[model samples]
Target: MKTELVQTFGSRFERSLIEEIADIGTWMEVPAGETLMDIGNYIRQIPLLISGVIKVLREDEDSDELLLYYLEQGETCSVTMSCCLGQSKSEIRAVTETDATIVMVPVQKMEEWMAKYKGWRSYILESYHHRLNELLHTVDNIAFKNLDERLMEYLKKKSEISEDNNIRNTHQEIAVDLHTSRVVVSRLLKRLEKMKKLQLHRNYIQILDL
Candidate 1:
């Protein structure tokens, strides 16, 4: 795990900082579909993804979750940073989109590193900026785009992140992510099929084109 972290970010950080991370970070493996964090919970550790993908979501009072963005290999969760900095409870959720390996650093170390390491500070700021932009894009899609367009955008994003156009998700699952009904998703998906943008199977969607 130390070697992996060094390989990932060693060039940007000092050897002493990397050594400290290795000593303090604990490796963890998370299976697909598992919830890594939940709303209103306090985060005690911050994870640096080593492999696979994690999806960050925001849930409403009714427990409807909307997909915010994905954290992939070599990325960290920005929301966790916010929680650590403020010592507040999480307002979002993080679920493993695929089987993932991560290194968890104690929350106290996160703050300490931010003050002690220039590289760590830059990484945190970059993570926050990236996540904020992603959330803003999500908001724009929801506020200005129709359901069909949003659904298409969501599918495209999933395909891009997963590095596969064959999306193995049901209409109901898609609806849940988009915060809509299955019927609506099915209807738009059918339209997409008719337009030859994608092909629908029983349990998956295959993109034929954009």
Candidate 2:
């Protein structure tokens, strides 16, 4: 894990900072479908992803969740940083989309690193910018785009993150992410199938073209 961290961030950080992270971080492996963080919960540690993908979701008052963005290889969760900095309960949730390995940095260490390491501060700032832009794009999609367009965009994003156009997700799951009824999702999916944009199977979607 130490070696991996060095290889992953050595170019961006000083050797001393990298060594400190390796010494203080705890390694964890999370299984797919596991929830890493939950709403209203206080977090003591933040994860630096080593492998696989994590899905960040924002929940509403009614407990409905919207898929926000993904944390892929070599990425950190911006929401986790926010919570750690403010010492506040989490407002969003993070779930492992695939079997993943992460380095858990204690909140104390995170705060220390932010103050002591230039690279750490830059990484956090960059993460915030990237995720904020993604969330804004999500908001734009929801506020201005039609459901079909949103569905297509969602499929494309899932495909990109998974590195496979063969998406192993059910219509119901997609509907939940899009905040719509399963029946409506099924209907639109059928239309997409008829249009030859994709092929729908029992529990998966195969992108034939786009």
The root-mean-square deviation over C-alpha atoms between each candidate and the true structure, in angstroms, is: 1.2, 1.2
Deviation (Å) of 155 in candidate 1: 1.1
lDDT of 2 by residue, 18-134 (tens): 788788888899999999989999989989998899999888778777898899988999888889889999998899999999999888887788899899889888999999999
Instruction: Give the TM-score (vs. native) of candidate 2.
Output: 0.96
Give the C-alpha lDDT of model 2.
Answer: 0.88
User: What overall lDDT goes with each candidate model?
Assistant: 0.89, 0.88
Clashes of each: 0, 0
Q: Name every residue pair that clashes in candidate 1.
A: none
RMSD of 2: 1.2
1-210 per-residue lDDT for model 1 (tens digits) = 778988877877778888987898888889999999899899999999988899988888899988888999878998888888899999989999999998888998887888999998898888899988988998899999999889888889889888899999888899989999999999999999999989999878998876
Off by over 4 Å in 2: none
